[model samples]
Every structure is written in C-alpha cells, then in structure tokens.
Target: MSKSNPVVIAVGGNSLISEKEKVTVEDQYEAIRGTVRHVADVIEAGRQVCVTHGNGPQVGFILRRSEIARKVAGMHPVPLASCVADTQGAIGWQIQQALSNELRRRGLGATHRGMAVSVVTQVLVDVDDPGFVDPDKFVGEVYQEADLPVLREEYPHWVLKPDRGRGWRRVVPSPKPLEIVELPVIRSLLEQGFNVVAVGGGGVPVVRGDDGELRGVAAVIDKDLATGLLATTLGADLLVVSTSVPKVSLNYGTPDQTDLADVTAQEMRTYLAQGHFPPGSMGPKIAAAIDFLAKGGKEVIITCPDNLKNALESGGGTRITP
Candidate 1:
C-alpha cells in the first residue's frame, strides 16, 4: 500500500500556450507557472499528485521545426517517435521546475519544495491495434496548396489531409496504450511522497518485438486514455481532467447546451453513444472517466486549471461518479 494516495491530473498541451498568437517560450513558461500555482494549492492542503500532460500543440511545434530544418539546412528528418520524446522532456521540465518554484514560494518544507520529478515514461501498445489501419491523429506542419506536390514527394508514406479549412497536415495512427514501462518507478516515487510528472504525450507509444525487445513506434496515443490507465494502476481514487472548459456540456456550442455538474458513468456512456461528445474534443475525456470509474476510481473532475480548487471544494466543475 502507498503511504500517500495521489490525485492524477491530466492537463491539455494547448493549455501551455494560452493563445494562438502568443507561442513563444516565455509565454509557455508563464502559462505553466500559473498552472503550477493551482497544483501547489492542492499540495498545500496535504494531498499528493501525479501530473500527466498532453503534447498536441507542442508536438506540432517540433514537427514543424523538423520540417523547416530539413528544407533549409539539409538536416536529417526527425521521426514521429522522436518528436514524442522531445515534447515529453520539454513539457515535463516546465511542469516540474514550475511546481518546485511554487512549492518554495509557499514556504513549504524541504520535501515539498523539491519533490517534483519528471519521468520520460514509455507506454506499451499492441502490435495489431486497428488504429494502424486508418491513421487519424493530426500532427502539425500544415502546408499550403502549392506545397502539396513537394510534401507528397518528400513524405510518400505520410497520410495527409485537409485540416478543417486551415491547411493540410500529416495524420498518424493513435493506438491504444497497453502498459506503462516505468509504472514501478512512478509508484515508488509516489509512495515516497514525491510528486511525479509522467506519461507525457501518452508515454512515447512503444511496442514489443517477437524477441521480447521494446521498440518505439511511429504513432500517437490519446493522453486522457493513457492518464486513466495510469490512475487505475497507481490506485488513485480521483482523476482530474484539466481542459479549456470549466465543465462538460451537452449539445456544446448550441442553444440547447446544458452544463453537467454531477453525472453518473452510465449517463455519460449514453450521452457518448448519442454523440454528445465529439471525438476530437470531449469524447476521449468521457471515455476516460467511464473507464476509470469502471476500474474502481471513485470520482472524476473535469474543469479548467483556474477552477481546480473550486471543483474540489465547492463543486465548480463537472463531476463524474460511478
């Protein structure tokens, strides 16, 4: 048994870049620092936390940079697996460092002030996941119509598609995560009262070979789903999903939209089946919540970073119960 039961919080990657136009390193640091303050609030209340983050926007930045480097400087192209690893390190560093500073700022003890550790985690996936048959996860590098011919010639194996009137981008498969390679390490860290940042970009998506060797794959995995598995494995009762919205809504963006405060797992599944949540946005969150609850999780809180405390104390966010 663990000495401390940590709450698993899954933060979205886009949250690190608050605005589309303001994507500088300075901007990202400030955003992460702000999020850390909220996390510190929970910690100050004497709770342990395991932080996991998404890497959609961050991965796009790396992929775009890789393309630019290859075209302008004749550098070798970066593979998809490498891009995931790069973002994991970069984002994990931001969260861990910021959390450390925040803990110190609160005049906490030595253990609290320096307890954050970022793990470049690896998650195993099935070799025959059906997502490989139809690649659908979109990465960055949106190209103009004039660049299509060159892109097609350069990346013949890539699956390119239009990005909802924005431009064209490469779509990779999002395979299901099976297991975390460093689960024991993370569990040990939590048991020792250390706050852990792990499973960045759904844990680098690896697969095993016939010879019992692990190999990185060229794919993405859903961060929320991966977070759910981590919470279940870590024996966490609470799974907090931090997104842009403060609460989950039905008929979102429409006049009939209704906010959910406290919802049951079965109701969420019914709403999910009725297509209330779209796959690109809220769908994975509900699916993750249901999976967690089914696997013995007590509650899930879906809210924005700003309302994290209120969601925990005063019901400021949507709650999912079993």
Candidate 2:
C-alpha cells in the first residue's frame, strides 16, 4: 500500500497490557508507547494510518477504581457506558500523543503527516439487540474467593463469571455495532490531512431511544467489528489488526496447528465455521477480516504489535485477501 491508500490499524486494548507486566497507568502508557513506535514505522514507510484501539483492560481499571471509591468515600459509581467513554478518551489520547511524539522523534515535522487526532467515537447499537438481555462481554477486575461475598452482595446486578479458576470477573453485553455516529466527522478529519484515531473500545456502545435521542448503554462493543466497519466505511484498502499473536493458526493450541502466512477470506471463513477460532479471542478478528473483504477491502493483516511493520513489508503475518 502507498501513502495514497490509507490503512486502518486496529490495536487491541488487552494487547496493550500483558499480565506479566506491571498494570499501572504509567506502565500502560509505556506499553502503548512501545506499540506506537511500530505504527510510526508504517507512517515512515509512506503510508497514511488511521488507528483504532481496544480498551478492555483500561476500562476494567476504571471500573475497579470506581468500585473502590464508591465503597470507601461514598462516591457515585461511574456508569458502564461512562467507563467505556473514559477509557476511549484516555487510551485514544495516549495513542494520539504517542504517535505524534514518535513521528517527531523520527524527524517527521509536526505537519509532515503527523498531526494525529483522536475522536471520542460513538457507535450505535440496536436497543432490541439480544446481547443486552444476555450480557457476556467481560469487564472489571477478577475477585478472589475472599472478596466474592462482598462483591456479590454489593453489586448484585453484575454478571460474574469464573476466569479459568483465576477468579470471578464481571461480564457485560457485547452488542454488535450497527453504525458509527461519528463516521462523518472522522471522514472529515481524514480528508483534512490528519491521521485519525477513532472508535476506542468499540465507540462507547450507545443505542437510540424511542424518543429519537441517542443514549449511552451498559454494553461493550467488539473493537475489531467496529474497526472493520470503519475500514469499510472509510474505503481503506488495508485493515491491520495488531493483536497478541504473530500469525493466525488452524487447530490452534493443538498438535496439528498450522500458522497461516497468507490465506483468502473464504478459507478463513471455512476455519471459523469449523471452530478453529473461539468467540473470546481470534474469532472476532477473523470475522472482521471476512466482513472487510466482503465489503471490498483489499487485504487484512493479522499479527502482534511488534510484527506490524514487517507484516506489511514482507507479509510477516497472516495476510487475508479477498
């Protein structure tokens, strides 16, 4: 892809913070900073970039802090939709500032295709979506056995699930995003020669009320799905989903597992139907890829943050084509 063909780079929020690393705010900034370097590499290689990011971990952090404040200081609890909004602004700012700084450090002047802007995106979801009735998107911190009784007693509305025996965590509905409310604004920003970062944590998951007003809802939208929509809507030829894996695999975690360097969207759909990708992880990404291709997207690159640069240059990751 050339500079004329902008690429939508979707970075996962959980991809920013690793369990092995410190989870402090400063640490989170450093994590994004590291990933920003690779994004700068793409920009330096003469490509316009529109960035989108996930906010699962960061949103959970806000939720945990709100719970603590509400219990200790009698502070009002932040709404779940508000928590998503908070992380969207916070994490979007981190990426925008980090990308700007990285570009500058590379001697790319402020106006040299480095004026990065973040849009506090609002993605619309259907109010009648079944997802709201059976919320399953995970958010917040995991509670140990000792803290379970208190958490359960206090937040009875929460849907807690066991996290592989690690602890119990809250799960919210992950509704499918119907439309991006700020689509026109983002398109305008791109047309004005700015690298836009929008749709953080799947665009603040909102729904339209019967009274014709847009209201925030307590749900998390899939970031990849939103990014795919953005890529299609913006008419970007390339969509890059920088996840935690270097490449997609078939029969993942098994002996017959095989890494895919290049595959067609049709092939990926076949694997998806066979249950090669689970819902909680790579499934959404593959689904996003297929959707993008179906909507006339030229290519999709799926790899970890570190491999993004090489993935574009030498097909270093799974390259899904139409």
Candidate 3:
C-alpha cells in the first residue's frame, strides 16, 4: 500500500465464466464488476494496481458467435487477435465502470481517484517458435466428435484434440511472450495512480516482419507469462495470480495432491522439472511464478478470486518468495 510499490494482478479466465452458464456479455460484465470491487478494495488501501486477464471463454464465445453469424449473413469474421482486442475493450470498460462506482461509494474519490484504462497491447513472439510447429494450447468451444469434420472443413488450420471425457476443441499456437509493446504506456498509467487493465488475452500476439514492421500474428500467448512480463517490466512488488483453486497443489486432482501454502522459487523449479505441473494446465502458472521471481520479483501469490484478500493478508495461497 505504498506509492513506491505496485501490485499486478492477473485474473484467470474461469473467474469470469462458470461451467454451467453461457459466456454472455452481461455475464462477463457482472464478473468484471466483482473483480473490480476486490481490486478497488486494494486501491482504497492505497496501493497502485495493474491488471491482466485471460480471455479463453470470452474469445471462444466470440469466435463461435462470429462463425454462426457468418453463416446467416456473409459478414467477414474477425481474426483471433481482433477478438482479443474486443474482449479487452469490453472487459476493460466493465472493470472501469465498476471500479469507478465502487471508489465513489467508498468516499475515496476525494483522496484517491480510481481510473481504469484498457490498452490494446501487442506481445512480441518468435516467428519460428516451436509452439507453432506443435500447437497445443486449446481455444474456442468444445465440440463432439461428430462435429469435428465440419469444423475441420471450416477451419482447416485448427488443431483439434480430444479431452479425457469432454469433446475436442480448437488449439492454437501459444508462444512465449518476449516483449510487451505497451509497457511504457502501462508504466505511465501506473505512475498516474490509475488502475490499468492491459494485456488482455496475453496481448494480441505479434511478430516482426521482414520489412521491419510489427505485424499481428495468429497466435495466443499464455496469460500468466504475459502477466509476469508485465510485472517485471513495471517492477511491481507483488504478482497475484487469481485461479480457481485457493492454493496451488502438487499432484493436483490426484489422490496424493498436496496443497502448498508457500514455496520458494527453487522448490517450484524442482516440481516443474519433475513434471509435477503439466504444461496443458498448471505448468504455465508455475513457470510464470518462477520467471517473475527469477527476474528480481519480491513475491508472487497464486489464489482464487474470492480468497484474494485472505491470501494476501494471511499468506493463504501458494506464495513464491525470493
């Protein structure tokens, strides 16, 4: 809660959408409102904040809608990067509105004015990253085996993988984020005491062209990695990752699962090396934590949204120390 140090919080995609409900615009707005309220609480405590969020469900919903809409009217569908920009705008607007109202209600407007701005960020990635050679990050809607042929014909480049019990979904190349294009702008916003929400959907992935121009690439970057990059670039004091679970666990979902309240970066590395974290899910989060700490980050907290306050105060979540 000091002026010198800021907090960068990354909210998971599942926080905005539940398993039962359809991911509608209204639902996303409501979810953003709840998230902003929590963020506003931190702001009221006199901490500067920046946020980055995942767009898995929202982008999937938009892509599916665009596909269906294109079927009725010959409207050209937007690209994946454009869809990420759209979610950034929509979700950012909701967070701004909610946080503004909450700040006004809490009478913090007099001393601490809260402003939320969404930046259409671009993240640089290697054009020849091996992730492209072997696309594995799942995106968009899940479909039954019967629907695969149709979807394949529709999106021939899409990689379809079968889930354990669930159906298949389109997977895209999720490359590591090397640089954040709007990092300077985010730093400016943070200096102005604004709660900036940038790097939505790991930022519209981009790569340099042969002509020395920055061009948008058809890929998604991992949100956690992007958030870590943002935190490191901004020199934030804490990187709080909001996920579904209150704390990260070793051997997650298995009978021998062990929840971790705190761990060092070295311990996380050991677990990662032993393949305790699977790349498909928890691997990126753990890797992001390690990367943050490796880059001189003071601390990182992994917890659920509802438990954020408790996690920060009581060290309830999986905290990675220096």
Candidate 4:
C-alpha cells in the first residue's frame, strides 16, 4: 500500500451532539470518545493528522448557560466572540484528552503523554465582508411566534430570522476566514509529532486593526471553510471533512438522491453551481473542497465518523480530486 498523505480533518458539530437529548457535557464527551478512536486509527496507520472541529451547538450551550445565569444569579452575558473562544477551548480539551487516551490504550504510550494540545486559534476575516451587511447565520435558542414580541422587546439589537421549519433564531454574520493567526505554532506542534487541535468553532473571528493588531469580531466563521484555508496554508496533501453523512449526495433528501464518489473538481463544481448543496448544509463544505483542490491539494474526502477508517484506507467516501 502507498503512504497516506498528510491530512487535515474537519469534524462537524454532529460528531459531538447527535440528538437534543444528549446535549450534556458528559454526553458530548462520550461522543468525542467514539470519534477520537477513528482519529487514532489514522495516526496508527502512519498518517500525519491535524484536526479542526465545529462548535455551533457547543457555543449555543454556553450562551444559553450565561443567559440563564444572568436571569437567575445576576451575571453578565458573554460576548459572541468570547463564546466562540470558550467553546474552542472546551471542545479542544475534550478532543485532545480523548485522542490521548485512545493513543495510550492502543499502546502508543509515548504519543499519549502530553503529545496532544489545543491551540486557541484566531482567524482573520475581512471587516467589510458581505456577511456583516446582511447577517444570516442562525445562532442561540429558537423562539415561538408567540414569543416574538417579547423577544424583540427584550433584545432589540438581535437580528431574528425564521429558521425554515424551526422557529425564529438570532442571526449573526458568518464571515469568510482569510488567515490563521497561529499557523507557525500549529506547524511546530505537527513537526514535533503532536496531535494539534486548532481553529475550533472556525476560530474566534478577528479583524486586523489600524495598528496591525488583531481585534475580535462578533461573527462565526464556517469551520469547514477555515479548515480548507488551514489545509492550503499548511500545504496538506488531503482535506477530510467528517460531517453527519457518510457521503456527499446529489438532490439530497429526495427519492432520487444519488451519492457521488471519485469525482473531479470540475464535476463537483458543476453540481455545486446547480444548487445541489445548500448554504446551510453541504454548500460551504463543497466550496471548501473545491478551494483546497484548486490550491494544489491532492484530494478532499467527505465522510462521517463511522466510515473514517474506510474512507482513509479504501476510498469509501466522496472523493474530490484536482
């Protein structure tokens, strides 16, 4: 068999919280345990692995907690950027701990002892991105039609939008990620044979100031998009996006849905243009895959946690090549 390429895997939020009933911290930790086993498999297979993960649900949990505490115990509401940073640390810690334990259990003791670390990553975005002009990223809790008036009265600064079939939710700008601020440190960690978890929750969104310093922005960057940027920046050979589904599909959720495999970048781009992927779902991921492949990436894999091993070893997932 040929050597596996250096891979960057972007784990989706579903990997942590599959259902609303299992939204507890311990429950999410259990979910990470399963996903990290798959990550450990890749490491044992001799593939250099770097990881990034989403934190939408996790951030909402933190915000909700803060809101509840403020109502009952007189605490200040956390800022949106601060919420992103909080989840990055919390989720990164869980992933590193779980990956380390799995490595040790597999008898890779040396790799387990302080070999995994989480970086509080920051990603720079254009301050004037169109997203800020028309914020549409749904966040936090949903409210019923009856509560709309009360919600509007309570939080007039929030932008409310109906979430399809779901109720109304506060929306925020989801700006595109331009740069990873801690790229050098991440590179150093990877060079030292450590499993590095960086850019959690698409990184705390930031912008460059007039003095050439970074300032946090109240927006959430798409984790997959950020991972694609990281992959291209690091010159990674492959980008693996572990989402909720095992494969990318055409006409998803329909009777005539079709799974795609071994597709070229041009072919995927055609499908993307045809609106096969929606922005709220697979659209950004496909865009990210195309971005990575166009930037000289060898391939991109779209798969779920359960099929990660097969996807890496036997070309099981939807593969997009340049």
Q: After superposition, which runs of candidate 3 have C-alpha atoms over 4 Å from their true positions?
A: 1-4, 110-112, 141-169
Give Cα-based local distance difference scores for all models.
0.91, 0.88, 0.83, 0.88
**lDDT of candidate 1 over 1-322, digit per residue (tens):** 5456799999999899988898988899899999988998888888889999999888888888888899899888898899889989988999999998888878874874356989999999998999889988888787888999987898799888888999888889899988999999998888888899999989899999999999998899999999999999988999999999999999999999999999999999999999999999999999999999999999999999999999998988999999
lDDT of 1 at 103: 89
Q: Single out the weakest 10-residue window by summed lDDT for candidate 4.
A: 1-10
Candidate 2 similarity to native, TM-score = 0.91
TM-score of each: 0.95, 0.91, 0.89, 0.92
Worst 10 residues of 1 by lDDT: 106-115
TM-score of 1: 0.95
Which segments of model 2 are wrong by more than 4 Å? 1-5, 141-169
TM-score (C-alpha) between model 3 and the true structure: 0.89
Q: Which of candidates 1 and 4 reaches a greater TM-score?
A: 1
1-322, model 3: which lDDT tens digit per residue? Answer: 2343579999887787754464677777777777778787778777777888888878887888887787799677778888888888877777667777788888876543566667888899999999999887776677899998777787787788986678997777988899998888877766776778899878989999899899886788998999999999888879999888888898889999999987999999998999998886789999999999999999999988878877777778889997
Give a tens-digit lDDT track for model 2, residues 171-240: 8888888899998888877777678889998898888887989999888899999999999988999999
Q: Name the top lDDT candidate.
A: 1
Give a tens-digit lDDT track for model 4, residues 1-322. 2222358999998679867899889999999999988988898887778899999888888888887887799787788999999889999999999998888888785752335789999999999999999999888887788988976776788788899979988899999999999998888788777778999989999999899988898899999899999999998988999999999999899999999989999999999999999988899999999999999999999999989999989989999999
